[model samples]
Target: MLKIRNLVGGYTNTPIINGVDFEISKGEFFVLLGPNGSGKSTIFKLITGQLPCQKGEISINDKSLSSFSKLEKAKKVAVLSQEVQISFDYTVEEIISLGRFPHQKGLFKTLSVEDKEVIEEVMEITKVKQYRDTQFRMISGGEKQRVLLAKVLAQQPEVLLLDEPTNHLDIKHTFQMLDLLKEWQQTKGLTIFAILHDLNVAALYADRIALLHKGSFLDVGDVDTLRKESQLETVYEVKVNAQSHPTVPKPQLLMTPNHSKTKSELLNFDTSFSITKNDQFIHVQFESPLRTISNGVIGEGIQWLKHFCNFHVEKHYNGSNPKQDLQKWMEKYEIPFEQSVAMMTAVRLEDVVIVTKQIEDIKVIAVVTAGTGNAVDITNSSLSQSHEKVGTINSMVFIDAHFTDGALVNGFMSATEAKVKALHDLNVKDPETNTMATSTSTDALLLAVTQQGKETQYAGSGTVVGKVIGQTVYEATHKAVQKYFHRLQK
Candidate 1:
């Protein structure tokens, strides 16, 4: 319902918005994103007529913005600017009542029933009703933001312009404000055009995003279009990692500081292994935090951790939740949970196999500990419901090679595939299914890399790094399994 074409304007002779053209559809939540001084606020001022338009046309519903009178524009458009300061200490109710001025009849206008109802409804919606009678200055900045938002909603305009609406709000209030706006946009069909700095917020709430850079639109499309890591890196001139939201499909950008250092840089490589022994556990410490990818019960998924440990307990020691037990053990030992990644395994430390191979000026290390006491084949036709033992085949592959984020994920998958290939090669069978066992009932694999030497872009089976991983893991797992089978034969 709001459209700007070739919009060019600025404070002085220099144009801040140069030849920008875009349209905001009716009932659409559109966001304008940019770094500081990228002309986001300038565009808002041009649209609201606060600053004189140097060139181009801005229209609302086929009507020129210049054609509308002040009161008429107020009725159609509501604006919430960044700087919200009051000269006098006004009550929250009094501030919200001012929004009804555009709809009032005369100078000494009395509050109509409809106006009072709208004010109350808005206060309730914005969750500012608790402090409705409190002085606006007395409440916190976040509360004040919600109060002002209530005032804007009180205006009941067709289109709302928000400039950093969630600036002063905490996480709770931030979500509340955005949720209210989203609900209004959907139910009341209120078209919203907002300027936001938080990429995650924009990704979650905005139907479409327009990325502004240096007085022009750099990219304008749906969230996916503007969520590219490279696109964001170029526009913001900072390192950005785009990841999916935990429970949603929206993309979130994580900023990496320029001075940030990885584990490989901080840890000295004096010894290949750093092992710590205790009566109940064995801690395997690393020189530095390694980029790890695993599906283990503890510290699953991709992360960076310095230590990996195996918790040992007596044969009679039974814990219902292994993870909770391991966490308690970690707390008892004063281990930094954030810095360590641990797993539970029944196999003894002496039975673990460690192998290393040097290729292309880099070293790849593989470690494996296997047990076939309770192996189960997933492809078996007859399903077994036995929960007697949690047989584990823990495998780890480490390389002194650098990798991109994509390669880390690919490395884990390739290593897992290689492990399964090793199982098939060793002729391990699931007794119940009489089929080649693909994996143990409880198998966990970790892929750690020092991130040194040449950068490996992708670690699929075809890549050099992938080849080393496959060969090492295949050989190492074969030996580890054979050792376990030899114990069984004894």
Candidate 2:
């Protein structure tokens, strides 16, 4: 464990870090964050005794840093700086063997059996064993970084101090280096105090973080508490958007650039819809990509899509892997799979309904293709037999406005509610249970937004935008369902 009390020091009489105090628990991964001139590296130098402390005391395990001699400090602490200058072409093995200097006995400073074992173990852990016999200067930047890490680990100290250890490493090596440090911290109880520039990486690995700005500690807390948009924007002098990571529980920050747009440009943002239908499929194309949330056979979940497809299949279509089949169909058609959202419907493509409505500056477009042959009353559907046919109802709602994540979800719910209302009013029923059907067994709904107009926070049924969405969806679904029934009568 390390502790700093009223730490104050800098290069000259003027101190870069002033009156800073914090404690690092044993085996804790603590990260220091700041801008270029925020005194992060100066603090690191002051703690390592490279620069004399003007006033205050730094101690490790209740022992003053001033009391530890050069050899004793080397045994307790190891430092891996951002860059190391090597004038002589030293072999990787020879460079790593130098870490055993403090542990060696007598005047010769020769490597003993324990020292050799430590060197080999460090090389293996750092994944630099193959480059052991090569010259350190001849390796790539990432390789040299790993070799330097092996050299420091050869010291086998209790605490490690790293200054931008992954600055020069690529994405793969960056994760590799952090993963190694994290494992060592968990297994060997090694304390880590590092200065990192990447906020997202720090969020993933650091146990605690300290935000420094203008010679003072702005904040020191966990990732959730410290990594706020307002705090980060003020410190870094840029606009930022903070959102939760999709797969992980941690928060991530996205930097937003400052760009200007004219009012005419915003108003003229193209959201025109184009539909092309044939016996095989119906395709809807948009001028630009829309932020979407859907549960379709392809392009499910959150995505940015420019094309929407509803592929027509036979009434008895029962593919074991419908998603793979849809993907193959897309490939055969030469569709850009990554930029499209698709679903399969057993209903006739000619019976589809499309409606577009404009309310003041906001606009909504609703598309629906409906049938009740495989409908299911979800409340009592558990008693019904399984149906493997394609979904009967496939609906898409497009809005020419910006939406938050909550608003997008609320809009989807509103659209679904409107579709059920349309079915209830039309007196549609499930063929098996003969009860009023809520939806098809595999109904798919997509909600997309142009994300260009005014920002709408909530899109519930009560909101203005939600009202338009519900009305448009209800009208479209009602017309489509009637058209399907008309076709059956013939």
Highest lDDT: give the candidate number: 2
* lDDT tens digits, residue span 1-490, model 2: 8999899999899999999999999999999999999999999999988899999899999899889999999999999988866778999899898888889999888899999999999999889999989998888888888888988888888889999999889989999999999999999999999999899999889999999999889999988854578988888998988878888888788888888556655534343667788878888888778899999888898788989988998888889999888889888887776888999988889888988887777788888998877788887736554555434899988898899888999999999999999999999877677889899887889998988867888998998888899999999999998998888899
Instruction: List the RMSD of every prediction in angstroms.
Output: 2.7, 1.9
Residue-level error in angstroms, candidate 1, position 182 = 1.3
lDDT by residue (tens digit), candidate 1, 357-467: 876766788877777665767778666734355356888777778888899988887888888899898888787877888887767788887766567789989988788
Candidates' TM-scores? 0.91, 0.95
Candidate with the greatest TM-score versus the true structure: 2
Superposed by TM-score, candidate 1 places the C-alpha of residue 130 at a distance from the truth, in angstroms, of 3.1
Each prediction's whole-model lDDT (CA): 0.83, 0.88
